[model samples]
Target chain A: MSFQISSQPIDLAVLRNALAHPHAGACATFEGWVRNHNDGRPVLSLEYEAYAGLAEKEGARILAEACAKFDLVAALAVHRTGHLQLGDLAVWVGVTAAHRDGAFGACRYIIDEAKARLPVWKKEHYADGVSAWLNCAIRGGFSTAAGPPSGPPTG
Target chain B: MKTVRIQYFALLREQRGVGQETLATAAATAGELYAELRSRHGFTLPADRLRVAINGEFAPWDASLTDGVELVFIPPVAGG
Candidate 1:
C-alpha cells in the first residue's frame, strides 16, 4: 500500500528514510499532531476510524496524483487510527523530488487531498466528560447520539 | 435481482449496529440501493452527505449495480 492507517505511534525517521534516494535533492514532510483544545473545549483525546477499503485506495490515488502533478520521485503518507492522546501524531506525509518546489507542492497537495477525500472520521474526547464525533454532522452527514458535533474538523 | 456486499463505516456503522452485510436487492442503481438501506437501517445521514463506491472504485450514485459487487457508502471524512 502506498499509504497506511496504523494503530501505533508514527516514527518520523522511518518515514524520512523511505524517501532516501540519490536523485532526490529535496524532500518535504508534514505531521499532524493532536492538540489539547478545540472550539472552546479542552480535548482529552480522540478516536479515529476509517472505511479501510476506500481509504487505502483514495490515499494511494492522492500520492500518485501528487507525484504526477509535481513531478515527484516518491511520496508516502501514514495516518493513525484509534485513540490518540494530546500531542500524538495523527498523520504524517513525505514527498521526495529532484527540486524543492516539487517536494513542497506535492506535500501540501497530498495532505489536502487526503483530508478532503479519505473515508476517515474523528471523535473528540473532551475534558467535560463528554466525547462526540467531530465534523460528522456537517452537510447532513452522520448525527451523533449526543446530537450535533460542536466543532468542525480542526485537523 | 442482484446480490451484493454492503459495508458500513463511521457513523452509519454505529447507527446500523453492523459493519458489513450481504443482501439480495432488486434495486437497479446504487442510489436506489442506498435509499433502501437508509430506510431499513434508519440511517440518520441522508444521501447527499455520502459518496458511493462500487467494487472499490468511486462512482456516481446512479451507476448500475451487478451481482457480487462490494459497495461502500462513505460518510464525511475528517482525516488530516
Candidate 2:
C-alpha cells in the first residue's frame, strides 16, 4: 500500500502496471482531471497548494482506514499539487483485490475520504478575469453522498 | 508543563497570519491548549469546521496533548 502527494501529474500507465497482479481478479482505477469549466464559467486553470507533510500523513491514514474496511489486496493513491492546467491528471487511485467488489469499494472510498479529510486547496482561475479560492467546506457542495468527481453539470 | 508544536496551513495560515508556533502550557488536552493559544493569538477559527492532527494522525478536539508533539490545524481544501 502506498499513498503519495506529489506536484507532478500522475502517470496512469505506471499506476496500472503497479496494481496488476496474478491473483487479483479485478483492478479498479480512478482518475481525476482538471476541468475547463465550473458553474458555467470557463476556467483557465487551477493552482493546488497543500501542507505537504500533514497532507501525506492524512492520506496514509485514509488508506489504512480503507484497507481495513475493504478486502483489498493493494491500494495506491496519488494526488498532484502546484499548478495544473486543463486536462491534466490531478489525482489517481487504483485498487486490486481477489474480487471486484473489494477493489471497487476501496477505490471509491479512498477518493472520497481524501477529498473530505485532506488539507489541499484549489484556486480556480476563470476566463472572465476572476479567480476564487475554494476550501473543503464550500466544495462539499460539489460532492454527493456517493463521492466527488460527479461530472459536468446539466443544462 | 509540556511544549506543543503547532502548524497551520491554507486559509488558516493566512487568517492566523503565522505559519507555525510552539507553546508551553500546562493544559492537559488538545482542546485546552487550543483554547489557550486562541486566546493568546486572537485567532477566530470555527470550532466545528477545523480538523486537528496530533503526530500525523487525526485526533478529536478533546484528545490529550503530549510533550514535543506536533499539532496541525487544517482548515479544509479542495481535492481532485
Candidate 1 per-residue lDDT, tens place, B1-80, comes to 89999888878888889899999999999999999998988877778777989998789999999899999998777787
Q: What ranges in model 1 sit over 4 Å off?
A: A138-155
How displaced is residue A91 in candidate 2, in Å? 0.8
Q: What is the C-alpha DockQ of each candidate?
A: 0.57, 0.42
**C-alpha displacement of B41 in model 1, angstroms?**
2.0
Clashing residue pairs in candidate 1, if any?
A: none
What lDDT score is found at residue B76 in candidate 1?
72
Fnat (0 to 1) per candidate = 0.78, 0.63
lDDT of 2 by residue, A5-43 (tens): 898868888888888888899888888888888767788
What's the lDDT for residue A81 in model 1?
94
* Model 2 ranges off by over 4 Å: A68-70, A128-130, A136-155, B1-3, B23-29, B32-44, B64-67
TM-score of chain A of each: 0.87, 0.84
iRMS (Å) per candidate: 3.0, 5.5
lDDT of 2 by residue, B3-77 (tens): 889887765676678888887889898778767766876555545556788887778988888899998876645
Q: How much is the lDDT of residue A74 in candidate 2?
A: 83
lDDT (tens digit, per residue) of candidate 1 on A40-126: 888889889987767888899899888889999889889999888888889999989999999999999988888888888888888
